[model samples]
Target: MSPPPEHRRAPPPTDAETLCRTGRKVIATEAGAVAALASRIDAGFVAACQTMLACRGRVVVTGMGKSGHIAGKIAATLASTGTPAFFVHPGEASHGDLGMITREDVVLALSHSGESVEILTILPLLKRLGVPLIAMTGQPASTLARQADAHLHTGVAEEACPLGLAPTSSTTAALAMGDALAVALLEARGFTEEDFAFSHPGGSLGRRLLVRVRDIMHTGAEIPWVPEHALVLDAVLEMTAKNLGMTAIVDAGQRVLGIFTDGDLRRLLEKAGDIHAVPVAAAMTRTCTRVTADRLAAETVRIMEGKRINALLVVDAAGRLIGALNMHDLLRAGVL
Candidate 1:
């Protein structure tokens, strides 16, 4: 007899469906983990936070395999959010990277099972170094947990993985718990946006948070200015020479009284008068918006946008002209 006719089966799903299903399951599992954590917060959680805040040195986070990756991210988040933290692979720490740690530091170890061999291998050395240990593990009674100075229960109900072998739900729980710790400490220390800016000095947030108007505003010779009594023609010359599109009209005390912009010049030109003979003050916007040089550039952007203007004169508390900034300055400063 001929071989049985081959039975054809339907092809597997497209990549998009698979990813969608996986993402939904992961999100559901993580939500459940966060829900579980709410009830579990107790004395131990407080102790863990206290241990981290009390440490004089950096927080050295460590883990093995997949947990190590999560540990690295946790360390980065902590470091960027005002906490000084760095990751050390458990395997590497056992070999020699343990020297990077000190008694003044705190060790945050991550393991889903709470029995990672590489992590356990260094427990004794960490103990010898007298470093406070904060354990993030699914099993509260596991060896790592028992040896820790503070054990944070990252126990998840189950993994999002169908086979329940991958470190899915557990890692999510651990990462959330790490964020909780970092944020708690961040709040406890009264850390501000300026502090965050220091850590992220090269990023967009740094520019927005740390850059003040004085840092980029045109001051001294760069400022386009003319006396209040100066004619419109002189104001135009000053504006053109400084290339700021506007000129500040100030009194003899250098206190800003008004501003004359290209728009104002246009309006003045439409009037039936001698532009050359008219004082610049007559064409200037007297109730002009102004900002202090010490104000944040980001705030200045908001003020400018809200006022529907392109330039502003930076002045002191007594209204003395100190500097000037335009939309182009904000654009160059990455605050626009």
Candidate 2:
């Protein structure tokens, strides 16, 4: 008998509290899955890292569906962290992308079931090519696990999905395992910050590690300067002409005596002092924060931020003013 539409039973709409609890439960489940993978890492994990490290060519990562997304991210992490790698779609491999794989390269396949048809289809071809295969899968007894040169078991107790169908816990476990392998290989290869900078030249890390003060500082005639004995008016003019909002007060030898800034001008005006009447030295900051040309621009940013100033004087060993850099320069150079 069909139930009346008005009396038909449907699961009650999930309440707000249940929704919040559901989200937390999913997160907790995935977190525990990732945590478990840490202790489960064994000799297979070490062998996988060794295989990747010895790969003379790029690491070609391939998978399908959710595993494919995780594989792409893993490949990126491996490449950026010193193991050159890129992703290949397994479905496309049999069509043509398999040509991208080479004997010098290694194949890293990702599949939760270890029985993805597309992946298995190419396994025999990969074997015939004599290329090393590294598999990341949850099913250790599955066919994909048995044929690999190294198999990294990323098995999880259960999926975070309430239905236990969607890839949640397993995916998190696999991603964490991938991160573990990448970092272990990174340490084993002795990858350095400079090497990391090379891989990420357009990012903030590259700016912090690669840019030096001399690379961005204003030099020669572009520097704003005034003689120590000059009146505050002349210092202000130099500051305006150079557009740095400040001027270095120097002695006859060009050694920095102090610095005068627009902030000093504001305070002087508030005190009802005459700018023309004041000697630059009287209005200048006597103990100025300075940097050398060889310093990392990021350090220069720290100095400005720490001192609450917008400008820095670049001096040599003798403390003579050689260049000047302001916050705008740092911003323009991507140091800010």
How many residue pairs collide in each prediction? 0, 0
Q: What tens digits encode model 1's per-residue C-alpha lDDT throughout 1-336? A: 655557556677779989899889889987897889887788889999899888899999999888999999999999988789999988888678989998899999999889999999998888888899999898999999999989999998898888889988888888888898889889999999999999988888999999999999998899999998899999999999999889999999999999999999888888845687888888899999999988999998989999999998999999999999899998998876
lDDT of 2 by residue, 22-130 (tens): 8899999898888888776888987898899899998999999999999999999999999999999999999999999999999999999999999999999999999
- Candidate lDDT values, in order: 0.91, 0.92
Which one is best on TM-score? Answer: 2
Alpha-carbon lDDT of model 2: 0.92
Runs with alpha carbons beyond 4 Å of true place in candidate 2: 1-3, 266-272
Q: List ranges where model 1 is wrong by over 4 Å.
A: 1-10, 15-22
Q: Model 1: number of clashes?
A: 0
